[model samples]
Target chain A: MEDNVKKIMHVMRRAPHGSIYTYEGLEMILIMAAYEQDLSIAFIGDGVYALKKNQDTEGISMKGFAKTFMALDGYDVEKLYVDRVSLEERGLTEDDLLVDVELLDSVEIGRRMTEQDVVIHH
Target chain B: MSHRFLATILNSDKVKIGILLKEGPYNHQAADTAYKFAEAAIKKGHTVDAVFLYNDGVINATNLTDPPQDDRNIADRWSKMAKEHGVEILACIAASKRRGITDDIMIDGGSITGLGTLTDIAIRNDRLLTFGD
Candidate 1:
């Protein structure tokens, strides 16, 4: 039963709603979580905006999926990480994020990335 | 137990590869790159299991895509690859609907599938490579 488990990482580098990459990436993560692979997500660059607080997409005519980040824990996707520089560069902090994530430097994040068998970057 | 490199280390010579394409044809080189990568992998004695299209990538499966006389027909290339190599070229149904791509316009050997199918491809294939932005 344990033979097929894979270490898959989803890397988010795009801003939310600007393009469909990050949004659709979230959808894929939600589904893969059910399969119980060793899944983790690293938010980098403008991808940190995806975890920001109080994102309302009413004007954009798109569904507010920022809240969806909070629901990922329910799907058993608890291993979430954020690039420290990316969050700080955007003038955001842990408090600005909608979810709890480990804020690590890109160096550390890259090390962990090397450990993943499949790394899907969005 | 799972190893660091799952398929390459455990499965001997031939690796089962699954591709996830996120961009469309003509506009970007993503579809072309994926096709070339799959072809190269197959030529090297690997099994190209599937090509799953998402977002704008679903446009690659549409038969309505007709290039000019001098240009390469990307959609036809995917069709031929699917037919000859037995690779499953699938587009996400939700994305296809948003892009006005219907089953009637789907290219030969291409089909519409759900995200669950993508999950299955990720699990079963030895290597799952994602292309595009």
Candidate 2:
């Protein structure tokens, strides 16, 4: 069967304080899409922490889960996003992030989500 | 806008669909459904442009993943599907970094763009879906 040319979007909402699996799961999908197929990403709620800067995981050293983010460029898996409201709620601004991010409010994020061929929430 | 018109517009050919994964696929059933749905759409002749990974969803690209033999390796499966097809996978650089998903070594296909790219994909695409945990 012929394949349709559509776009996929992945949204993240979990915080980093708990488990790294949530963030990692999202990473796996992006790698698959950017490297293998085609896809994109978005952030909302507590998920904004996935992009914070100077995480200082050294104190806990729980496998350095956030470090995997640097690999995005190599995989051509760009498209990092954040939730404006979520970020503000956590007292985090774009400046506090370790990587570059595009912040969107709930309404804007919702509008953007409708543009994808498929959306998977992790 | 009327539901009929909106549905027609969303379902139009010019529309591209985007899926958002807010939690880890292991914890989120919606994520699994979305992936399956995308594959189904492709088999149905629908084109899936890009699959963006932000926040917790960024973990999908982690190379260190090692799911059990019996369990479905969602990450690897997605990678294989993307490779077989022409799907674009994206990871939120900030989200990944915050969660400690750094690229000590270089991998292919994946990138570290920005949220604007997601917006561009959404605005340009026909449909955007979210599989929230």
Candidate 3:
């Protein structure tokens, strides 16, 4: 029922352009966000790169979607999270990201994941 | 008493499952694994409402896929399961269009649908399991 707002979390674990998973994953997220469900996104591993600042896909002939992350808040899908260990392992910090995301430890992320009604990983 | 009895049955212990497969057949084990999981669940008396195809998973709904004589036809495998078990096998329209999979070429017991349908599957089912890289 629309009355039960589901806690759905989309987990991004892949890098952009390596395959269409991250991009398609994002597309799925946007569509679900319109359902008025409680939605959240988590970036781990290479997925953190999707939010990296200054992505250039012109040379690869791919439509740049990094900027799309910034517009997600306009959809009311504001719970963007990043794995702190994943960012630091890649020598990145909050400043390296193109969107404002909550830096969460693995434990915190796992706890959030457990509370979700559904978790989709890409 | 009647209301309490109806509520008891409505809250059945069996899970209602919805599967999302993102990989194509053969190249990845996601399709096979999802099929087996669905089969096992149905055997255990659970309800497997649908299997939604996204990404290259749309490839699984095409009858044009023909493997060698000795090989397992993955497309046929899905078709058979859908026919025998009455499970809804759906492929995303946008993904299918991108891959050139039209309704005319779709395997038996499968249909082309949209992401909005996927949203329904995710919301209506008790469990939504995703299989992909």
Ranking, DockQ, top scorer first: 3, 1, 2
Worst 10 residues of 3 chain B by lDDT: B6-15
Once superposed on the true structure, which residue ranges of model 1 sit more than 4 Å away at CA? B1-11
Q: Higher lDDT: candidate 1 or 2?
A: 1
Which residue pairs collide in model 1, if any? none
Q: What is the C-alpha lDDT of each candidate?
A: 0.90, 0.68, 0.92
Native contacts retained, all candidates in order: 0.57, 0.30, 0.52
TM-score of chain A of each: 0.96, 0.80, 0.97
Q: Judged by TM-score, which candidate is best?
A: 3
Per-residue error at A66 for model 1, in Å? 1.0
Native contact fraction (fnat) of model 2: 0.30
Candidate 1 lDDT tens digits, A1-116: 38688889999999988888888889888878988889999999999999989998999899889878999989989999999999999999999999999999889999999987
Tens digit of per-residue lDDT, candidate 3, span B1-133: 6999986797588898999999999999999899889989999888889999999999999999889999888899889889998889999998899899999999999999988888888889889999876
Angstrom error at residue A60, model 1? 1.9
Standalone chain B TM-score for every prediction: 0.90, 0.81, 0.90
Residue-wise C-alpha lDDT for candidate 3, range A6-122, written one tens digit per residue: 889999999999898889888888888888889999999999999999999999999999888999999998999999999999999999999899999999999999998899998
Model 3 docking tier (incorrect/acceptable/medium/high) = medium
Model 1 chain B: lowest-lDDT 10 consecutive positions: B1-10
